[model samples]
Target: MTLALSVDGLSVWYGEERAVHSVALEVPVGKVLALIGETGSGKSSVALAAARLLPPRARMEGRVLVAGEEMSALSGAQLRRLRGEKVGFVTQDALAGLNPVMRVGRQIAEVFQFHRNLNRRESAARAVESIEQVRIPEPAAVARLYPHQLSGGMRQRIMIAIALALRPPVVIADEPTTALDVSTQADILRLVRELCAELGTGILWITHDMGVVAEVADLVAVMYAGRIVEHGHAASVFDRQQHPYTRALLRTLHDMRAGQPGDPLFQIEGQPPSLNTVITGCPFHPRCPMATSLCATEEPVSQRFGGLEGTESGLVACHHLGDQAGAMT
Candidate 1:
């Protein structure tokens, strides 16, 4: 299968402070790779940089390959052509991402206009088709309404419709289901999974919710302190987590294991390190339960246990993997 996106040695800096380390990832065609981490762990920074969407003051290094283009080397016009045409982006907050003043249908049509050079009638028809594809009720009516006039879920579906209108090879969904009710969230996720599969679109799903990853992700890459601490198949990563951080995040989930009603939730001790602080060894050591002198002064080597690349079961980064049988799920 062809990979929709690939990042090699990707790193980003805000002035002298580094926000992302040498992070490498791949999202194969029709698969979702979840970039999981708590806030400030630099997962979003990595995803945004993959699309050349980082902030103005941020400096980036390494290669981001997508849609037959090297993102890091693209010229201004070429970069614009790549986004929304070959690489679509779905932001977290639909209400914020869409213009309140613009009619929903017109906004979706703009994507067709930019990439397809379609006339207004053609764009409008295609936009309604997209709205229908996303399963919105009465596409024609929704098309005429402004963003605020729709429910949160409707607005989100509209956003997804815009992304799908171009049939991009890859879609970057940054918490697209956030701020929605539980039922709405499920609908949005199902829509994304179904639409991407139908279109053969690779997805980079960035979220802090392990439950979301469990339900939708084919592969998982756990990020902490600007670096990937563990990456593997979603099943193995959760069933036999090799890194302390991955285990900690899993234990924090509400449904992972049975606990007393009065018991406090499990949480990783200590705070995530600030970007201003530099560490020579594993950045997570301070919060990791298995930290040692080696963890404090040296980087952990990545170990691949599987033969097939991108299979999701054969990888980990750690100095203390312990006995696999006894490791926390």
Candidate 2:
């Protein structure tokens, strides 16, 4: 299977503080790879860096290839063209991503005009079609409306329409369902999955919602601090989680399903550490229930597990796999 997006040893830093560390992953065409972690876990940093949209204050290292084009090797003009033609980004905040002053139609049409060189009349027609593609009713009327004039869900649908207008080979979505109501969130999720699959577009979905991951991901990468702690097929990661953090996260998801309205919710005990904090061993050792002296003193390297008896393989960074397995028993 060919990859639509590939990252090898990708790292990002802001001045002296590192936000992402030696991350590696791949998004195969027509598949969805969900990157999930709590806030400050460097999930967004990895996504933004992969998209080559990092701010100037941030510095990046390692290689990122999108649609088989290495980002680092592309000239400014070439990079811009690559982004416009082959990459689509659906941001978390639809309002922030759109031009407030411009009608949603014109904003979506601009992509066709600039990248595909469609004239105003042609691009305008295509914009309406794209809006309809997202299942937004009354596309022409909605297209003429300003961002502020539309409801949150409508604005979000417009964002998706704009991103997919060019049928980019790769789509990077940053928490696309953050603030929508439950029903609308489900609608948006279904729409995005259907549209991407139809277009044969691979996705890098950056989100904290485990429910969202379970819903759409073909593969999953769980991040902690700045490193990926667990990664594999979504089924393996969720059904046979290897890392302590991954297990804890799924426990939270279980709590959501098993709890009542008046019941107290389960949550992880400690907040994530700041990027400025110094670390000597596993970044998660301070909060890991399975942590031991070894976990505190020696950083754990990633070790492959599973692939036995027809099981899918996975990578995990944990010193006490044997102990964790025993605990699970």
Candidate 3:
């Protein structure tokens, strides 16, 4: 499959604070790569960096390639053009993303105005179409409503409508269903997956939900602190987890044993270290149960597991994979 987005040694800093560290990954055309991690794990930071939407205080390094172009090197104008035309983002908070004062239709129409060069009438028609495409009932009526008028799920669908309005080659959805109810979350995930598949759009889905990851992700990248700790086929990573952090995350999801009392929910002990602090070893070592002297002093390089290359699939960063089962205490 052709690579839609490639990130190499990508790092980001907020003034003097480092938020992302040497993160690398690839998203192939028509694939869903779920960037999974808890809060402050740098998942959303990676997405924002890819879209060139980071705040002015952020200083970036390394490469972010979108459809073969070096995104990190693009001029401001070029980045804006690329962002709406080639890559679209549905942010975690739908309410914050939309303009509360503008009618939803006008907001959707703006996509056509900016990217498609459509006149007022044409853009209005297209906006209605976009609204319908997202399965909003009575598109015309809904179009006239402002952001504050819609339910959380409806607002999120509107966000999706705007995102897919341009048919961009890549889409980044950060915590796409965070505030919705469970039923609504399921519907939103289904809509996102179906739409992306139909459009053959590469999707970078950033979320902390393991259930959502299992449902929609083709591949998974587990982030810890500011780095990718494990990445692989979703099934492989969830079913045959290699990294201790990854294993700990999955173990928290359900009872590992069917009949017996399942292990207690394993919580990583400490808070994520401050970004301003200089990390000398595995950032997760402080919270990890299996931490050894080596873990405290040395950061493990990402290596292929399940017999594959780093770029191909099945990658992990940890010192004791061979001893994982026994390491969990």
Candidate 4:
């Protein structure tokens, strides 16, 4: 089966600073791939690069194929057409994603106008349909209201509705349900999963929430310092994480799950290295507990794990996995 989205050796740089380095993954149609990492781990950068939405100052390299088309090769007009028509995006900040001055209905209908040859009435009808599909109550009234009138959850739902209006084959959602109550977050994620399954849309879900990943992800890619450190079937990655960073994240989640009470939450120590600094070895070495002297001098190439049957493309970038086999366990 052809992948809905395939990224190979993708890298992005902001002038002299590299934000992401050689990240790659594939999202098959009807599958949900979660890109999980803490803030500033280049999760959002990866999402933007996939959609060809990176800033003017940023330079990108490598292949980003969406629906068999090379996103990086598309021209201005072609890329514009592909953005909303072939690939949709729901940004992390719904308030910023939506136009404050425009009516929510018109904002959504604009997608139809841009991607489809629908008149005002037809576009309005379709926009209302999209809104209802995302489970927004009183779709008509919600359509008539401005972005300011809606609650945070409602705004997020509207963002999703707008994104799905054109039925794009790939959806890149950057923390689409953040800042909502637990109940609302569940509802939003369920709606996204259901809609993607029904439409066979590939979803690249960028988030830091492991709970959400456990609920919706078919595959999981753990990113750090702008590169994918570990990727595999979501179940396997959760059950048997390999990379030290991935293990730390899982331990943090376990701490949260146990309802550990304290203002001082557990976190990986040390800050991420500056993008301008040339990282000779693993970018995660400074904070990695299992890092060896070799890890500080040589970069570890991603390698497929052994002892796993029916697994493909599962990779971990680490030098100590051989010696620290029992660390994650």
Candidate 5:
């Protein structure tokens, strides 16, 4: 399969603290791979590392390739060109990601002018086209307004338009719909899934929402405390979760569905380990209900597992994967 983005043993550290550890991920063309975990699980760090957008204080190891081009090998100008041409990024917050002073149309038009080297009029026209591509109505009129003038959903659509303006091979969306209302979130999700498929763009979608994964992801990677504990096809991962953390997360989803009003929200016990904390054995052992003494003293390597014949196989890292009582419904 042709991959739009590949990360091999990618690790990120901020001084003495490590945010990501030997994480590997792949985003194949025309598919969505949701990198999922709770806050501080290093999902965002992996995204930043993949895009070479990590902060100056962060040190990175391993390799990242976008559209078959190695990021570390590219020069400064080449790296900039690579970002503009090969990869697109949609940040979590639209208002923060966008320029408050610039008109939305001009912001998108600059992408065309800088990367595609289109003339002023050409770029302006293309900006409207990009906006319309995201399903925004009256694109030309909306394009002329500043980011602040638009509604939350429209601002998010603007961010998506900017990200996809160049039709880059790979797109990274970091929780782009977290702030939107239920109906607006559904619209945004559908818009992104349709646009990426039409353009044959591979998307690395970072989110904590399993519901979102069920809606849009073709594949899923479960991250916990800076490491990937599970990786597999979305259907396989959801239907037959093999790791304790994965089961816990899915249980929350089940509870949300089966619960009554004012019921206490289901949550995984214990907070995720801090980046500065030294972790021996499995990073999730402290919080994992299925963890044993072996889990506390020794790390579990990934193993292949499948639910039924002809199903897509997946990787899970858990010492007690065999114990399957009360499997997530």
Candidate 6:
């Protein structure tokens, strides 16, 4: 079967300011691939590209395939169908995603009406069912309320309800649980996991939280300076990360110390270069402690270490993966 989502040699730019640099990834059916990066790392840019959701001024290169259809090459009408029925997208800010003037129910009902060509009455019933599926109480009443009338978590559930209602083959969830409380966040995460396990929907999960990634991701990709620096199985990347950027990120994960209270967090030196900044050699060399003279002037190609069924190696773009591997053993 064709992959649910395939992004190859994809580059994105906003008026010559690069947002994504030749990033490539795939999310197969029933799997979750999480993109982890700090702010402005271009994780969201890649996610949006999966549905051809980039801003009007943003020029995109390469091709995006959604369940075997080339998204970038599609006509406007075709793109709309792909976005509406083939891939469901959930944004981080539910309030922003929802129109304040539109009642939540009518908004979700639009999916059934537009995609499935259901009549108003039928669509309305399905809309309520969608709400109930996400475990929102008082579905009918909740649907009648405007987006602002609902709590943050409730609004997010509505977003998920809308996305899952159509049973899209691929789901791009861009930090869907970032704004919710811990308990509510866990509920949403569990819902997404269950969807993947039971429904066979491939998911591209974009978030900055490693905890969230650990909870939901089967595969993990680390992005830095608009490019994927490393990608591999979650277990492999977490237990034995290869890229210096990946290692630095893992080292900074908060831990429960045996006796020490409030350990000072490890911080990576320097900040990520701006999108317009001219980066020579490795973009990460400026802040990476393991950088050498060679790293300062040469870009490293991705090298594989290990993958699923042992066919794909954990891929890393770093000058010292070999030395890092030796040191680990």
Best by lDDT: 4
Across 43-120, the per-residue lDDT of candidate 5 in tens digits comes to 888987887777889999988888787886665777787785787888877798899999999999999999988999
Task: Check candidate 2 and list the clashing pairs.
Answer: none
lDDT of each: 0.82, 0.84, 0.83, 0.84, 0.83, 0.82
- The superposed Cα distance between candidate 4 and the true structure at residue 251, in angstroms, equals 1.0
Clashing pairs in 1: 232-312, 233-312, 233-313
Off by over 4 Å in 4: 176-178, 256-266, 306-313, 324-329
TM-score of 3: 0.91
| TM-score against truth, every candidate | 0.92, 0.92, 0.91, 0.93, 0.92, 0.92
TM-score of 6: 0.92
On lDDT, who's better, 5 or 6?
5
lDDT of 6 by residue, 1-329 (tens): 34888899989898989989999898888888988887788888898777788889988898888787778877688788768588889887788788999999999999999989999999999999999988887899898999889888788888888888888888888875345655566667678878666778888887655676777788899999999999887888888888989988876666411213333323566789998899898999999889899998999988877544542467899999999889978
* Model 6 lowest lDDT segment of ten: 256-265
RMSD of 2: 2.8
lDDT of candidate 3 vs native? 0.83
Model 5's number of clashes is 0
- Give the alpha carbon lDDT tens digit for every residue of 177-222 in model 4: 3366656776777789999999999999887667878888999999
Q: What is the C-alpha RMSD of each candidate to the true structure, in Å?
A: 3.2, 2.8, 4.2, 2.6, 3.1, 3.2
The sequence of per-residue lDDT tens digits that candidate 2 reaches over residues 136-176 is 88999988989999988898888888878888889888875
Given candidate 5, what's the lDDT at residue 191?
82
Residues 1-329 of candidate 3: C-alpha lDDT, one tens digit per residue: 57778899999999888889999988888888999876788888999988888889898898988778778778778778777778889898998899999999999998899888999889999999999988889999999999999999999899989888888888888865347655677688778888888988888988656777788888999998899999888888887787878877887666322322322223455677877877878888888888999999999998776555333358888888667646543
Q: By the TM-score metric, which is better: model 3 or model 4?
A: 4
28-105: candidate 1 lDDT, tens digit per residue: 888888888877888778878987888899999999988556778885888888788777887877777899999999
